[model samples]
Target: MIWVHLLIVLAAIFLGARYGSIAIGAAGGLGVILLGATGAPVSREDIPFDVIGIIMSVIAAIAAMQAAGGMDWLVALTDRLLRKKPKRITLLAPIVTYLLTLFAGTGHTAFAALPVITEVAKENDIRPSRPLSIAVVASQMAITASPISAAVVFMASVVEPLGVGYLTLLAIAIPSTFLATVATSFLANMLGKPLSSDPVYLERKEQGLIELRGAHEYEERPGAKRSVLIFLIAIIAVVTYAALISENLNIISDPTLPRTEAIMSIMLAAAMAITVLCRIDPSEILGMQTFRSGMSACVCVLGVAWLGTTFVSTHMEAITAFAGSALTAYPWLLAVVLFFAAALLYSQAATTKALMPTAIALGASPIAAIAAFPAVSALFVLPTYPTLLAAVEMDDTGSTRVGRAIFNHPFMIPGIVNIALAVGLGFLFGSLML
Candidate 1:
C-alpha cells in the first residue's frame, strides 16, 4: 500500500493533469481497491472531507480575489512601493511575498506576486530570476511561519498531544525559516547576475517582454486608491480574526471548526467590502465561471490527498513499525527523512497527516517533530507543485524549469537551510524536548 501511494504520486507528477483532478481521481480509486483487496478496514467516512472543504474554499477565495482584480491592485501597490531602488526592490519583494504567504496560508499568493517582482527586477536591471526565486523561496518559508497554513495546523494537531505548544513551536520555526529565505535570496542574487546577463534576458529585453506596458492604464482608475484601502483593511481584519480564533478568543472554538469556515468568512467579508466600496456586484467579482475553474484546479490535490490517506491507513501498522525501528537507530536523521518525504509528497498537509502520528509513536519528541515540520512543509515549492505549474504556464517563461534546474537557486537551498536552521535553533533555544 505504501508503495502504491508512492507510485500514484509519481504517476500524478509524470502524467501532469491539467487541473489535478484526473491524477487525484485515479489515486483515490486505486487506494480504495487496494485497501479492500488487502482486507483493510475502509469506509467512505474515513475520508478527510473537512480538508477537502478547506482546500476548495481557499482556492475559491483566491479565485475571487483574482477575478475582482484585487490581486492586480495589490501588485500595483507593491510596485509603487518598491520602485525607488533596486536594492529596496530586492529586499521588499521577498518580504512582501513572505507576508502574503503568511496571510493567505498558501504559496499561491506568493506566486501571484511574482509578476510584480519580475517587472521590478526588469526595471532595475536586476535579474528577474533572483526576485522570482526569492518570491518562491519566501512562500515556502512562510508556510512554516503561517499559523493558519495547513501544514502548521496539521503539525500542531499531531504534536500537541506530545507536549509541544503551538506558539512555542511556531516561535522556533518562524525566525529560522525567515532567515533561510533571506539568505537564499541574497545568495541567488550573487549567483544569478551572470545568468541574468546571459543571452536569454538580453533577448527578452530587446523583445520588450519585461516592459510594464499597462502600468498607466491600471493606475488611472479613479477609485483605485479607496478600493485598495478597503481591501487592505479587510485583509488585516481577516488576519486578526484568524489569530484571535486560533488563540481561543474568537467566535469559533471547536478545534474541528473546519479551516474552511474561517477562510470563507474572511473571503466573503472581504468580497462584500470590496463590492460595497467599488460599487460592483459580488457575483460579478468572482463570476460563476471563475469559481468553478478554481475548484477544478484543486480537485487533483483533494483526490491525491484522500488516496494517500487511505493508502497510509491501510498499511499503517507495518510502515509505522519499520519507521520506528529506523528512527530509533538514527534519531538525528529525522529532519533529513522528513525533508525527503515532503519533497515526494508535495502537499505539506497530506505529508503531515501521513507521517506525523508515526513519528510520535516512534518515541520522537513533539518538539523534534514539530521543528522538523518546516522542512517537510517546504516541499510544496517543487517545480511539480500544482500551483507552481499554473504559475509557470501563466508566465510562459521557462523560469520554473530554469529555477528547478538551478536547484540551489531558490527552493532546494532555502528548503535545506530552513530545516537545518530550524532544528539547530530549536535545540539552541530549548524548544526541542531532548
Candidate 2:
C-alpha cells in the first residue's frame, strides 16, 4: 500500500510537469485524493496554510508596488548601472538579479532584467550566456537568503524551537549565499567562447538575425521611487520586528503576534499602504504579472505541500527508522537530498516545508539544517524553469541556447556550482557562528 501510494504521488508530479503552471498544483490535489483512497491517513492541517498565506501576502505587496511602476523604476536603475560598466557585466549581472529577488522575495523579477543583461553583454562583445546564466541562477538562489521569502521564513520557524533564532539563520545565509553567488559569476565568466568568436553567434550575425540593441529605454514613472521606498521600509519593519521578538533578543517577550503572523500582517499592511500612498488602483494589482505568478505559486504550494506533508507524516516512524541514523551520521547528506528534491518540486518553499521538518524530527543538527537551507535553491537542474527559459529566449547572440540534451544547457554548470559552493560556505559560516 505504501509503495502504491508513493507511485501515485510520483505520477501526479509527472502529470503536473506535463501540464505546467497552476496545473502542477492541481495535480498535487489529485494525488492527495488518490493517497487517501489508498488508505493513507490524510489531514486538512497538512495543507501548509501558513506557507501559502506568506506567499500570498508577500506577492500582494510586491504586485502592488509593481502596479505603481516600482518594478520598472528598479529595473531602470539596474539598466543604467549595467551600461556604465558593460565590460564587467558578467560579474555584475548576477548581483543585480540577486538583489532584485532578495528584495521582491520572488525570482520572477529576473524577467525584467534579462533583456537588459543580454543587450549590455552584446554591446560589450561579452557572451550573453555568461551573465544571463549566472543572473538566472542568482535570482533563484537569492530566495533562500531573502528575509521575507517563504522558504526562509518557514525555515526560521522550523529551527527556532531547536535553539536557532531568526537572526542567526539570516546571518549565516545572507553572507554565505552572496559570496557563493559572486564566486559562481567569476566561474561562469570563463565557461563559453567569446561572443565574437562563437560559431553560432557569427552565423546569426552574418544572417542579420542578431540585433545589437543598445540599452533599454524605460519611461520614468512619477511614483516609481516612492513605491520602492515604501516597499523597502516595509521589508525593514518585518526584519526589525522579527529581531525584537527573536529568542536571542526577547525584546518582545511573550508577544501576542508571532514572527510568522507578523510577517503576513505586515506584508498585507504594506500592500494597502503602497496602494493608498502611490494612488495605485487595487484592480491594477490583480492584473499585474507579479500578482498572477504569485497566485499560481500559492496554488502550487497548497497542493504539493499538502501532498508531501501528508505522506511524510503518515510514515514518519518507518522513514525515521530507515534513514535517521544515516542522516545523523552524515549531516551534510541533508543538503544533497534538498538539492535534488528542489529540482523536482520546482519551489524552494514547497521543498523546504515538505522536507525540513522531517530532517529536524530525525535529529539532524539545527545548524546543519540551516546550512542546508540554501540547497533548496537548486531549481536550475531542470531547464524548464521560467527564469531559465526566459534567459535563453532573451539572448539574441545565440550563446545561451539549450542543447538537444536538455540538462546540457548554459544554466546547468553555473547553477550547480552556485548551489554547491553555497552549501560549502553555509557549513563554513554555520561552524563559525553557531
The top-ranked prediction according to TM-score is 2
What is the Cα-based lDDT of residue 206 in candidate 2?
A: 92
Q: CA lDDT of each candidate?
A: 0.59, 0.90
The residue-by-residue lDDT of candidate 2 on 279-316, one tens digit each, is 98899999998888999989988888888888888889
lDDT for model 1 comes to: 0.59
Show model 2 residue runs off by greater than 4 Å.
Answer: none
Question: What is candidate 1's lDDT per residue for 162-242, written digit by digit as tens?
Answer: 655456566776776776666656665664445355666567657776445333225434444555565456556655655
Best by lDDT: 2
Candidate 1, residue 354: CA error in Å? 2.3
Query: Over 4 Å off in model 1, which ranges?
Result: 1-31, 34-40, 60-69, 193-196, 203-279, 285-297, 328-332, 380-382, 386-411, 426-434
Each candidate: RMSD: 4.5, 1.2
Residue pairs with backbone atoms closer than 3 Å in model 2 (clashes): none
